[model samples]
Target: MGRWEPDARGRLRAAAIELFSERGFDQTTVADIAERAGVTERTFFRHFADKREVLFEGSQVLQATVIEAIASAEPGTPPIETVAAAMQAGAGLLQGNRDYSRLRATAIAANPSLHERELLKLGRLAAAAAEALRDRGVAEPAASLAAQTGVTLFSVGFEKWLTDGAVDDFALHIRESLAELKALTGDA
Candidate 1:
Protein backbone atom coordinates (compact mmCIF):
# COMPACT_ATOMS: atom_id res chain seq x y z
CA MET A 1 0.00 0.00 0.00
CA GLY A 2 1.09 3.55 -0.69
CA ARG A 3 -0.33 5.00 2.51
CA TRP A 4 -0.97 3.24 5.79
CA GLU A 5 -4.66 3.03 6.32
CA PRO A 6 -6.53 4.25 9.43
CA ASP A 7 -7.98 1.99 12.12
CA ALA A 8 -10.80 -0.44 11.42
CA ARG A 9 -13.70 1.84 12.30
CA GLY A 10 -12.16 4.84 10.58
CA ARG A 11 -11.28 2.82 7.52
CA LEU A 12 -14.74 1.35 7.33
CA ARG A 13 -16.44 4.74 7.61
CA ALA A 14 -14.19 6.41 5.06
CA ALA A 15 -14.59 3.50 2.70
CA ALA A 16 -18.36 3.69 3.05
CA ILE A 17 -18.41 7.41 2.31
CA GLU A 18 -16.27 6.99 -0.76
CA LEU A 19 -18.18 3.98 -2.08
CA PHE A 20 -21.60 5.43 -1.34
CA SER A 21 -20.62 8.68 -3.00
CA GLU A 22 -19.26 6.90 -6.04
CA ARG A 23 -21.69 4.05 -6.68
CA GLY A 24 -24.60 4.89 -4.39
CA PHE A 25 -25.28 2.89 -1.21
CA ASP A 26 -27.48 0.38 -2.99
CA GLN A 27 -24.73 -0.55 -5.41
CA THR A 28 -21.86 -0.72 -2.93
CA THR A 29 -20.78 -3.94 -1.27
CA VAL A 30 -18.80 -5.00 1.78
CA ALA A 31 -16.11 -6.52 -0.40
CA ASP A 32 -15.72 -3.19 -2.17
CA ILE A 33 -15.30 -1.27 1.08
CA ALA A 34 -12.94 -3.82 2.54
CA GLU A 35 -10.84 -3.63 -0.58
CA ARG A 36 -10.81 0.15 -0.49
CA ALA A 37 -9.93 0.30 3.20
CA GLY A 38 -7.11 -2.16 2.75
CA VAL A 39 -8.62 -4.35 5.40
CA THR A 40 -9.92 -7.87 5.40
CA GLU A 41 -13.65 -8.46 4.91
CA ARG A 42 -13.64 -9.86 8.44
CA THR A 43 -12.09 -6.66 9.71
CA PHE A 44 -14.83 -4.56 8.22
CA PHE A 45 -17.40 -6.93 9.64
CA ARG A 46 -15.76 -6.62 13.04
CA HIS A 47 -16.22 -2.87 13.08
CA PHE A 48 -19.62 -2.52 11.46
CA ALA A 49 -22.62 -4.82 11.28
CA ASP A 50 -23.17 -3.75 7.69
CA LYS A 51 -22.29 -1.03 5.19
CA ARG A 52 -25.00 1.23 6.59
CA GLU A 53 -23.53 1.17 10.09
CA VAL A 54 -20.30 2.50 8.67
CA LEU A 55 -22.13 5.56 7.41
CA PHE A 56 -24.09 5.92 10.64
CA GLU A 57 -21.29 5.45 13.12
CA GLY A 58 -21.41 7.27 16.45
CA SER A 59 -25.22 7.33 16.47
CA GLN A 60 -25.35 5.24 19.64
CA VAL A 61 -23.17 7.78 21.38
CA LEU A 62 -25.25 10.63 20.00
CA GLN A 63 -28.46 9.05 21.25
CA ALA A 64 -26.95 8.51 24.67
CA THR A 65 -25.78 12.12 24.73
CA VAL A 66 -29.21 13.50 23.83
CA ILE A 67 -30.90 11.27 26.36
CA GLU A 68 -28.38 12.03 29.07
CA ALA A 69 -28.74 15.72 28.39
CA ILE A 70 -32.43 15.49 29.20
CA ALA A 71 -31.81 13.36 32.29
CA SER A 72 -29.22 15.82 33.57
CA ALA A 73 -31.43 18.84 33.03
CA GLU A 74 -32.82 20.70 36.03
CA PRO A 75 -36.21 19.73 37.38
CA GLY A 76 -39.34 21.72 36.43
CA THR A 77 -37.84 22.86 33.13
CA PRO A 78 -40.20 22.81 30.19
CA PRO A 79 -39.90 19.85 27.78
CA ILE A 80 -38.58 21.75 24.77
CA GLU A 81 -36.26 23.75 26.99
CA THR A 82 -34.85 20.51 28.35
CA VAL A 83 -34.33 19.17 24.85
CA ALA A 84 -32.50 22.37 23.87
CA ALA A 85 -30.37 22.14 26.98
CA ALA A 86 -29.52 18.51 26.16
CA MET A 87 -28.65 19.42 22.58
CA GLN A 88 -26.27 22.07 23.89
CA ALA A 89 -24.61 19.48 26.09
CA GLY A 90 -24.38 17.02 23.20
CA ALA A 91 -23.04 19.70 20.82
CA GLY A 92 -20.20 20.32 23.23
CA LEU A 93 -19.17 16.75 22.57
CA LEU A 94 -18.95 17.53 18.84
CA GLN A 95 -17.07 20.80 19.11
CA GLY A 96 -14.29 21.26 16.56
CA ASN A 97 -15.33 18.09 14.69
CA ARG A 98 -17.18 20.03 12.02
CA ASP A 99 -15.34 18.84 8.94
CA TYR A 100 -15.73 15.16 9.70
CA SER A 101 -19.32 15.71 10.78
CA ARG A 102 -20.17 17.55 7.58
CA LEU A 103 -18.47 14.93 5.46
CA ARG A 104 -20.32 12.12 7.21
CA ALA A 105 -23.69 13.84 6.95
CA THR A 106 -23.22 14.67 3.29
CA ALA A 107 -22.35 11.07 2.53
CA ILE A 108 -25.41 9.84 4.38
CA ALA A 109 -27.66 12.37 2.68
CA ALA A 110 -26.29 11.29 -0.69
CA ASN A 111 -27.59 7.74 -0.30
CA PRO A 112 -31.12 6.52 0.33
CA SER A 113 -30.06 3.69 2.65
CA LEU A 114 -27.96 6.00 4.78
CA HIS A 115 -30.74 8.59 4.73
CA GLU A 116 -33.17 5.99 6.07
CA ARG A 117 -30.72 5.15 8.82
CA GLU A 118 -30.44 8.85 9.57
CA LEU A 119 -34.23 9.03 9.95
CA LEU A 120 -34.16 6.04 12.29
CA LYS A 121 -31.51 7.76 14.37
CA LEU A 122 -33.67 10.87 14.56
CA GLY A 123 -36.69 8.79 15.56
CA ARG A 124 -34.76 7.08 18.33
CA LEU A 125 -33.47 10.43 19.51
CA ALA A 126 -37.05 11.67 19.70
CA ALA A 127 -38.17 8.63 21.66
CA ALA A 128 -35.26 8.96 24.05
CA ALA A 129 -35.97 12.66 24.50
CA ALA A 130 -39.61 11.88 25.22
CA GLU A 131 -38.66 9.24 27.78
CA ALA A 132 -36.50 11.75 29.57
CA LEU A 133 -39.33 14.27 29.64
CA ARG A 134 -41.78 11.66 30.83
CA ASP A 135 -39.58 11.14 33.86
CA ARG A 136 -40.19 14.82 34.55
CA GLY A 137 -43.97 14.15 34.62
CA VAL A 138 -44.75 16.04 31.44
CA ALA A 139 -47.98 14.52 30.12
CA GLU A 140 -48.82 12.49 27.01
CA PRO A 141 -48.50 14.10 23.60
CA ALA A 142 -46.77 17.07 25.18
CA ALA A 143 -43.70 14.99 25.82
CA SER A 144 -43.93 13.21 22.49
CA LEU A 145 -44.57 16.44 20.66
CA ALA A 146 -41.80 18.26 22.46
CA ALA A 147 -39.31 15.46 21.89
CA GLN A 148 -40.14 15.15 18.19
CA THR A 149 -40.02 18.91 17.81
CA GLY A 150 -36.67 19.03 19.54
CA VAL A 151 -35.23 16.35 17.27
CA THR A 152 -36.50 18.17 14.19
CA LEU A 153 -35.07 21.45 15.41
CA PHE A 154 -31.77 19.77 16.11
CA SER A 155 -31.68 18.30 12.59
CA VAL A 156 -32.56 21.65 11.05
CA GLY A 157 -29.89 23.35 13.11
CA PHE A 158 -27.28 20.72 12.26
CA GLU A 159 -28.02 20.93 8.50
CA LYS A 160 -27.94 24.70 8.62
CA TRP A 161 -24.66 24.68 10.47
CA LEU A 162 -23.18 22.31 7.90
CA THR A 163 -24.45 24.09 4.76
CA ASP A 164 -24.88 27.75 5.72
CA GLY A 165 -21.08 28.36 5.86
CA ALA A 166 -21.87 31.35 8.05
CA VAL A 167 -22.11 29.93 11.56
CA ASP A 168 -19.43 27.87 13.22
CA ASP A 169 -20.94 27.19 16.59
CA PHE A 170 -23.20 24.10 16.56
CA ALA A 171 -24.49 24.68 20.07
CA LEU A 172 -25.54 28.24 19.41
CA HIS A 173 -27.37 27.22 16.28
CA ILE A 174 -29.14 24.50 18.25
CA ARG A 175 -30.30 27.05 20.77
CA GLU A 176 -31.53 29.40 18.06
CA SER A 177 -33.22 26.54 16.26
CA LEU A 178 -34.91 25.33 19.44
CA ALA A 179 -36.20 28.80 20.11
CA GLU A 180 -37.52 29.08 16.59
CA LEU A 181 -39.14 25.66 16.79
CA LYS A 182 -40.71 26.46 20.11
CA ALA A 183 -42.17 29.68 18.80
CA LEU A 184 -43.46 27.93 15.74
CA THR A 185 -45.08 25.18 17.79
CA GLY A 186 -46.55 27.56 20.36
CA ASP A 187 -44.48 25.92 23.05
CA ALA A 188 -42.88 29.22 24.04
Candidate 2:
Protein backbone atom coordinates (compact mmCIF):
# COMPACT_ATOMS: atom_id res chain seq x y z
CA MET A 1 0.00 0.00 0.00
CA GLY A 2 2.82 2.36 0.81
CA ARG A 3 4.37 1.44 -2.56
CA TRP A 4 1.56 1.42 -5.07
CA GLU A 5 -0.86 3.86 -3.49
CA PRO A 6 1.96 5.21 -1.38
CA ASP A 7 -0.07 7.41 0.93
CA ALA A 8 -2.39 8.88 -1.63
CA ARG A 9 -3.24 11.77 0.65
CA GLY A 10 0.42 12.78 0.96
CA ARG A 11 1.05 12.49 -2.77
CA LEU A 12 -2.01 14.64 -3.46
CA ARG A 13 -0.86 17.25 -0.93
CA ALA A 14 2.67 17.46 -2.38
CA ALA A 15 1.25 17.75 -5.85
CA ALA A 16 -1.19 20.42 -4.79
CA ILE A 17 1.56 22.44 -3.14
CA GLU A 18 3.74 22.26 -6.21
CA LEU A 19 0.91 23.17 -8.52
CA PHE A 20 -0.31 25.97 -6.30
CA SER A 21 3.18 27.38 -5.99
CA GLU A 22 3.89 27.13 -9.71
CA ARG A 23 0.57 28.15 -11.20
CA GLY A 24 -0.99 30.07 -8.33
CA PHE A 25 -3.66 28.53 -6.11
CA ASP A 26 -6.54 30.12 -8.00
CA GLN A 27 -5.21 28.95 -11.33
CA THR A 28 -4.52 25.37 -10.25
CA THR A 29 -7.33 22.87 -10.70
CA VAL A 30 -7.92 19.54 -9.03
CA ALA A 31 -7.05 17.88 -12.33
CA ASP A 32 -3.71 19.68 -12.34
CA ILE A 33 -2.94 18.39 -8.86
CA ALA A 34 -4.01 14.88 -9.75
CA GLU A 35 -1.94 14.95 -12.91
CA ARG A 36 1.10 16.17 -11.04
CA ALA A 37 0.68 13.32 -8.59
CA GLY A 38 0.34 10.84 -11.45
CA VAL A 39 -3.09 9.99 -10.10
CA THR A 40 -6.61 10.48 -11.31
CA GLU A 41 -8.82 13.43 -10.42
CA ARG A 42 -11.02 10.88 -8.68
CA THR A 43 -8.06 9.90 -6.57
CA PHE A 44 -7.52 13.51 -5.64
CA PHE A 45 -11.13 13.81 -4.54
CA ARG A 46 -10.77 10.59 -2.62
CA HIS A 47 -7.96 12.11 -0.60
CA PHE A 48 -9.36 15.64 -0.45
CA ALA A 49 -12.67 17.25 -1.19
CA ASP A 50 -10.90 19.97 -3.14
CA LYS A 51 -7.58 21.70 -3.61
CA ARG A 52 -7.99 23.92 -0.51
CA GLU A 53 -8.06 20.76 1.58
CA VAL A 54 -4.54 19.89 0.48
CA LEU A 55 -3.19 22.75 2.56
CA PHE A 56 -5.54 22.13 5.48
CA GLU A 57 -4.86 18.41 5.82
CA GLY A 58 -2.01 18.67 8.29
CA SER A 59 -4.04 20.87 10.63
CA GLN A 60 -6.53 18.05 11.07
CA VAL A 61 -3.85 15.45 11.58
CA LEU A 62 -1.98 17.75 13.92
CA GLN A 63 -5.06 18.36 16.05
CA ALA A 64 -5.79 14.66 16.38
CA THR A 65 -2.18 13.74 17.07
CA VAL A 66 -1.79 16.46 19.68
CA ILE A 67 -4.96 15.44 21.43
CA GLU A 68 -3.73 11.86 21.62
CA ALA A 69 -0.35 13.01 22.87
CA ILE A 70 -1.96 15.14 25.56
CA ALA A 71 -4.25 12.33 26.63
CA SER A 72 -1.28 10.03 27.10
CA ALA A 73 0.91 12.53 28.92
CA GLU A 74 1.92 11.71 32.50
CA PRO A 75 -0.94 12.29 34.92
CA GLY A 76 1.24 14.40 37.15
CA THR A 77 1.86 16.91 34.36
CA PRO A 78 -0.05 20.15 34.70
CA PRO A 79 -2.76 20.88 32.12
CA ILE A 80 -0.70 23.53 30.40
CA GLU A 81 2.35 21.30 30.57
CA THR A 82 0.39 18.50 28.96
CA VAL A 83 -0.67 20.83 26.17
CA ALA A 84 2.89 22.04 25.74
CA ALA A 85 4.12 18.48 25.52
CA ALA A 86 1.57 17.82 22.78
CA MET A 87 2.78 20.87 20.90
CA GLN A 88 6.31 19.52 21.14
CA ALA A 89 5.07 16.26 19.69
CA GLY A 90 3.48 18.23 16.87
CA ALA A 91 6.75 20.06 16.29
CA GLY A 92 8.44 16.69 16.06
CA LEU A 93 5.88 15.59 13.50
CA LEU A 94 6.71 18.60 11.33
CA GLN A 95 10.47 18.78 11.91
CA GLY A 96 11.44 16.21 9.29
CA ASN A 97 9.58 18.11 6.54
CA ARG A 98 10.99 21.61 6.56
CA ASP A 99 11.19 21.81 2.82
CA TYR A 100 7.57 20.84 2.45
CA SER A 101 6.57 23.30 5.16
CA ARG A 102 8.46 26.11 3.44
CA LEU A 103 6.72 25.30 0.21
CA ARG A 104 3.27 25.24 1.78
CA ALA A 105 3.90 28.36 3.84
CA THR A 106 5.16 30.26 0.82
CA ALA A 107 2.29 29.02 -1.27
CA ILE A 108 -0.21 30.10 1.38
CA ALA A 109 1.46 33.46 1.78
CA ALA A 110 1.34 34.08 -1.94
CA ASN A 111 -2.30 33.18 -2.34
CA PRO A 112 -5.15 34.94 -0.59
CA SER A 113 -7.41 31.90 -0.88
CA LEU A 114 -4.81 29.66 0.70
CA HIS A 115 -4.21 32.21 3.44
CA GLU A 116 -7.88 32.26 4.41
CA ARG A 117 -7.97 28.49 4.52
CA GLU A 118 -4.84 28.44 6.65
CA LEU A 119 -6.39 30.77 9.20
CA LEU A 120 -9.53 28.67 9.31
CA LYS A 121 -7.44 25.57 9.77
CA LEU A 122 -5.66 27.16 12.72
CA GLY A 123 -8.95 28.16 14.32
CA ARG A 124 -10.34 24.66 13.86
CA LEU A 125 -7.27 23.13 15.42
CA ALA A 126 -7.56 25.41 18.43
CA ALA A 127 -11.21 24.60 18.85
CA ALA A 128 -10.51 20.90 18.66
CA ALA A 129 -7.84 21.29 21.28
CA ALA A 130 -10.15 23.22 23.57
CA GLU A 131 -12.64 20.39 23.31
CA ALA A 132 -9.91 17.94 24.16
CA LEU A 133 -8.91 20.08 27.15
CA ARG A 134 -12.48 20.04 28.42
CA ASP A 135 -12.43 16.27 28.19
CA ARG A 136 -9.21 16.30 30.20
CA GLY A 137 -11.04 18.13 33.04
CA VAL A 138 -10.12 21.71 32.26
CA ALA A 139 -12.65 24.52 32.85
CA GLU A 140 -14.24 27.02 30.44
CA PRO A 141 -12.06 30.01 29.73
CA ALA A 142 -8.91 28.21 30.80
CA ALA A 143 -9.57 25.43 28.35
CA SER A 144 -10.06 27.81 25.43
CA LEU A 145 -7.28 30.10 26.51
CA ALA A 146 -4.81 27.29 27.03
CA ALA A 147 -5.58 25.79 23.66
CA GLN A 148 -5.27 29.11 21.83
CA THR A 149 -2.10 29.92 23.70
CA GLY A 150 -0.65 26.59 22.63
CA VAL A 151 -1.49 27.36 19.02
CA THR A 152 0.02 30.82 19.24
CA LEU A 153 3.23 29.48 20.73
CA PHE A 154 3.40 26.84 18.06
CA SER A 155 2.94 29.46 15.35
CA VAL A 156 5.56 31.83 16.71
CA GLY A 157 8.02 29.00 17.31
CA PHE A 158 7.51 27.64 13.82
CA GLU A 159 8.08 31.00 12.16
CA LYS A 160 11.08 31.79 14.31
CA TRP A 161 12.66 28.45 13.49
CA LEU A 162 11.80 28.80 9.83
CA THR A 163 13.18 32.34 9.63
CA ASP A 164 16.40 31.21 11.27
CA GLY A 165 16.67 28.40 8.75
CA ALA A 166 15.42 25.97 11.38
CA VAL A 167 18.68 26.44 13.32
CA ASP A 168 17.00 26.29 16.75
CA ASP A 169 15.50 23.07 17.96
CA PHE A 170 11.75 23.29 17.21
CA ALA A 171 10.75 21.76 20.52
CA LEU A 172 12.96 24.11 22.48
CA HIS A 173 11.61 27.07 20.58
CA ILE A 174 8.06 26.05 21.52
CA ARG A 175 9.03 25.68 25.14
CA GLU A 176 10.63 29.13 25.14
CA SER A 177 7.64 30.59 23.37
CA LEU A 178 5.36 29.04 25.97
CA ALA A 179 7.48 30.51 28.75
CA GLU A 180 7.32 33.92 27.09
CA LEU A 181 3.56 33.60 26.79
CA LYS A 182 3.31 32.70 30.46
CA ALA A 183 5.43 35.71 31.35
CA LEU A 184 3.22 37.98 29.28
CA THR A 185 0.00 36.68 30.85
CA GLY A 186 1.41 35.79 34.26
CA ASP A 187 -0.31 32.44 33.85
CA ALA A 188 2.70 30.51 35.10
lDDT per residue as tens, model 1, 1-188 = 22444566776777777777778778889999999887888888777888877756677888898888888788888887888788777787777878778777767777676688789888988898898889889898999988988887778878777877878888888888876765786845
What is the alpha-carbon lDDT of model 2 when measured against the actual structure? 0.82
Query: What's the CA error at residue 146 for candidate 1, in Å?
Result: 1.4
lDDT against the true structure, per candidate, is 0.80, 0.82
Worst 10 residues of 2 by lDDT: 160-169
Superposition TM-score, candidate 1 onto the true structure: 0.84
- In TM-score terms, candidate 2 sits at 0.84
